[model samples]
Target chain A: MRITSETVADGIREQLFTIGDIPGVLWTPAEGSGPRPLVLIGHGGGSHKKGWEVVSRAFPYVTSCGFAVAAIDAPGTGDRPEHPEIRRLVALTQEREAAGEPFWSGPEWPALNETVAAQLIPDWQTTLDALRKLDSVGDSRPVGYYGLSQGGEMGIRLVAAEPRITAAVLGLVGSDWLTETAARVTIPVEFVLQWDDEGSPRDSVMKLFDALGSAEKTLHANPGSHFRVPSFEIDSSIRFFARHLGGPGTASGS
Target chain B: MRITSETVADGIREQLFTIGDIPGVLWTPAEGSGPRPLVLIGHGGGSHKKGWEVVSRAFPYVTSCGFAVAAIDAPGTGDRPEHPEIRRLVALTQEREAAGEPFWSGPEWPALNETVAAQLIPDWQTTLDALRKLDSVGDSRPVGYYGLSQGGEMGIRLVAAEPRITAAVLGLVGSDWLTETAARVTIPVEFVLQWDDEGSPRDSVMKLFDALGSAEKTLHANPGSHFRVPSFEIDSSIRFFARHLGGPGTASGS
Candidate 1:
């Protein structure tokens, strides 16, 4: 069989936005076309949008097989300006780490202003709405998301709260956040669990899966740690969005 | 309860390791008391040892709770010898992806050279002998191995080839290798599977677990993708190692 030349060129392109007074950077793909299924991503604790490059570059290899991906640095990471909520989160984390609280030993640094919680759900909504509004991305595509660690929580909340997400990939995090944000969601979800993830253990995923009000669900477990980033994980994320998101490359029927 | 800062510091520290063949950078942690259980980790295809920094460094965090950890990066990737086998594996991937042939996916990776194949079992032995011979790791402690993707296959082979491995962690790889290498292992094993991994999905893990010869075994499934590395994966890797591999920081008594 003759080999196909599948060209894959990737980069971090961005748009600036504000979550209230806090300035934020929307990290997205440079080569998106046709209503590329948007991928609104969030970063984990202590990290920002910079942590998302792995997915942005990798999704195209698979997602590009059919969709466009966009990731946003949470309020504090990357070029985004720090919000007052971030300050509160830091202060709370310090106090907890000082008190040597058990949660410190667990994942999640801290979120001081619970209102940031309210703003959090809208981050993806705002991005997806904007992406759909983009001239390049008209009304023909379904948006999706992939998040890791702390971002995993954000991704789950977004899809659960908004119907815009046709599909979603949650890596190393859980949907427990939905108890407050989304009581139920209809989209098909793919969950990627890291076997030895300390930040969010197996218990978290199990609990979250049980809470999922949706019936369309899939799960994959691979032996890995939070620190190890490799191509395999990238491949999975790409394949996932390719399956769920609607794009010129992937027909809604596919 | 007054929490000790030392414990927290140690818990967070196992996650750190010196990368590359910087002569000084070995898996051995800074001087600690007594000999600890040893583990040699190898990475999946198209990757190297240092390639696992994201996954392997947290071994110490597990160690702080008290078992020493070392992430093994096989020849090639993150500073290992460019062995012929590694070269072939890379070539196969490039060719297959270019071929764009759907059949050329999953564990269909070309076989390791007979030399590499024959040594799979012994390579681990050599690693153990080398570790035991090290000034830092003595023979007083037990040893085990853990691997992911391609590494997962190797971990099983290593344990199956050598009884030195008291426990093994296998994730997202072919289960047949266990059947091929079953006689060699006689330790506890943990298998993690994602419900919808693009490659080796959930059924694969159950098959591997069912075929395994170990008297002590457990199967864990998570909602995740092959690409989305999870926090639980890291937590489990470290926890498994800490329990099987004896050292100072890990919680003992498994």
Candidate 2:
């Protein structure tokens, strides 16, 4: 990975880097005495390394809690140029959405999903490989993963394939394709579920949760739309990761 | 089917009707002395009974050739009320399209495509059933099918299921899912293929044509984009349908 920029902000040292062809960011507590636990973030579709709007908001809180955060743009979004086929689809989607249209009920969704899955899983693994080699994050540094929606959907594959990730926070990602991946994830997990997600039905969400193979997993659910995750719930996820990755007595990392 | 409007212009009589819940239109020679051959039309995605602009432009010519023509809005388009799921999908498609975004490189396209296929084929069959009963049509009317792009993609299923369709003109649609459907379509076919379709690669289009089960089928290929079917090709399709559905010497139905 090649570092492109480095800056200090609010007691955090943030660096922009590229791992192979994938662009990413590293955020760590500037005053930490030793190597801190590392958290890899997966941004959703139409999002970038900064983790989209919702995800970007969490970087500061997670970093202040004494952990390093790293995130890369999902394959077709952010700094990575979108594939030509994907570019066409995004244009069509935007045109239809502007007309107040829906997208899921057609036959194209499944194929598009497959294309995206094929593109994302490898990048997630590559990002993880590059992050673990950085000076701020040694090979043995405890690694955690946090992703929701597109992030969570793809993170399942990453966590299942990479055993180095000690824990993961997965949310708003529910699909039958995850059944096998969920079964392979033995890491500590805190899965977030929103009850009324039009994009992802509740039953599918529950089915994904039910399929997780983790021995130590918790289900944190709320009754709201998929994008409406409450701050308290977000804190719970932070606490969950802190307990597992930041060592005991570090739950409040502050 | 319930006829709602009837008008005659330039020797063609056009009747607007509803087959079950699907809004449709019937075009026939106003001077036809008896029940002429019938050709059912399947409009493309985001289009209605009138067909997309391209297909609509061909209607009078086809009707003038001594054949009755019928077309209905595919599920979620045209006069038919869009399915709630479809509406959401269309809105999303529009939103993504307008943003110059890429969508299908993601996983959603396949699922949405299946939903559209499931909805369209049955509606096509139902419309066919209702169309045959019209006094202006009659039970023994020789039947043919015509569809392009979204129309052609979904028409494979309809033609395979509806044996009464003696022939079909399908083009500008190419997907692996059509392999099995194409294998089941035994009717005489005049398949159209555009060489430079960004939406449908040439190899896939040729593969679909090669997969057709028909003993007597022809490929009418041209060098153009998907939406730019040449006028001569349209005439060739008209003649093919005439040879299969209308009597000999009726190729020029003028």
Candidate 3:
């Protein structure tokens, strides 16, 4: 692991780092130096690690809960070098979308996601292994994952395979292909759905929520299109993570 | 209105009162006086004004938000005289339950609800009128309603007819008869749904939620039976009401 750059502002310390070929960013309370809870945020499709959705949630987890938060660019996003296959698949899906046709029904949609997940999921596991060794984010602390849309699509697969994640806030994607994978997720979950989401219909999202094998999972559905998720949900997520992971000064994990 | 009994405990002042023939109870912060936000709680079927569900939410609203909370006994329940028609309908529904049959599918269920609503709706409106006149709960403050199950059945009707209520936390019911009434309620709402509820199936409840006209409505669906709504929901409601009605010591309403 290598730290490439560092900056501090608004009581938060931001570090840009790389583990092997994968690039990522981590945020922590500027004043704290000890191990604390960590939340990994996954950005949506076509967005980089520092996308608005990722930074919005990361900033709060750092400032309010005094936790370390991190985000990594996917295989062809952000600072990463472009891949030919991913570019071809994205262009095909976008062509369908531009013609006012359903893009997700085509084979390219799942193909694109599969290609990204094959690389990003392993990248995330490697990132976690390296991050836990750091003094400020030791392995003893509880871990959480927050992702929506494409992030949620990948999160179900990641959380199901990863044992370190104890809680998650995932939703906004409703791929039928993920049913079996979703059933493997037993951690407490807070799933979100957009009532009028065009790409991910409410029923499809609800079906994924029902498939979750967790004993404690709650679905929070609000009105609007996919991108119009109400801001109050951010406040709700803070409380959800606080309750499950415990805050800075509280007893979290062994 | 006559205050037949008064007591103070745990920083909450409880007043048992009667508005004409309606028996009711009111709770408020013991440390403060004068007008504040008021929340009217409607009890479930077979439960009275001070039912466990009502007291649990009322005490928190009073102590946590310093808001005045009140609950009134529906017709043929609590201090009210028995109605032979209501008795017959309940007996029929109980028999269906004993026989392992779906009681809500039969006419007796709607008949029982209609019998209760006939008298209770007018009584509630009259009670609200009298409560708002009290010095401690003046008409100028914003009002909210909390009810579930049988309470939700009646609350949908009440909130629809009464324009004064600005917000409500209602669920645990899916009466198809109330679909049109639910649409008339345009205030902000926090709707709850118990995923595995026997009587109120998740689909039915979701349908009712879908019919609600409130633009700011949110659906919170948790995995549990109808009566097993998690305790955290109570804490969530406190925040919901505080945000909508404004807490005591805050600039609430004119």
Query: Candidate 2's residue-wise lDDT over B72-185, tens digit each?
Result: 777777777748877777667667666776443334455667788787778778887887776556766688888888778877888888888888988777788779989999
TM-score of chain A of each: 0.74, 0.88, 0.97
lDDT of 1 by residue, A143-199 (tens): 776666666677666677677677776656654545554347557666666655665
Per-candidate interface DockQ score: 0.07, 0.01, 0.92
Report the lDDT tens digits of candidate 2 across residue range A40-125: 88777677777554355456545646777888776677788758876666666666666776555444455555677787778767
- Model 2 C-alpha RMSD to native: 24.2
Model 3: colliding residue pairs: none
Instruction: State model 2's lDDT.
Output: 0.72
lDDT of each: 0.55, 0.72, 0.92
Candidate 2 residue-wise lDDT at A61: 45
TM-score of 3: 0.97
Error of 2 at B48 (Å): 1.3
How do the residues B154-243 of candidate 3 rate in per-residue lDDT, one tens digit apiece? Answer: 889999999999999999899898899999999999999999999898888888998999999999999989899988889889999999
- Which structure is stronger by lDDT: 1 or 3? 3
Candidate 2: TM-score? 0.47
Please give, for residues B129-151, the per-residue lDDT of candidate 1 as tens digits: 65565444567677766666777
Best by lDDT: 3
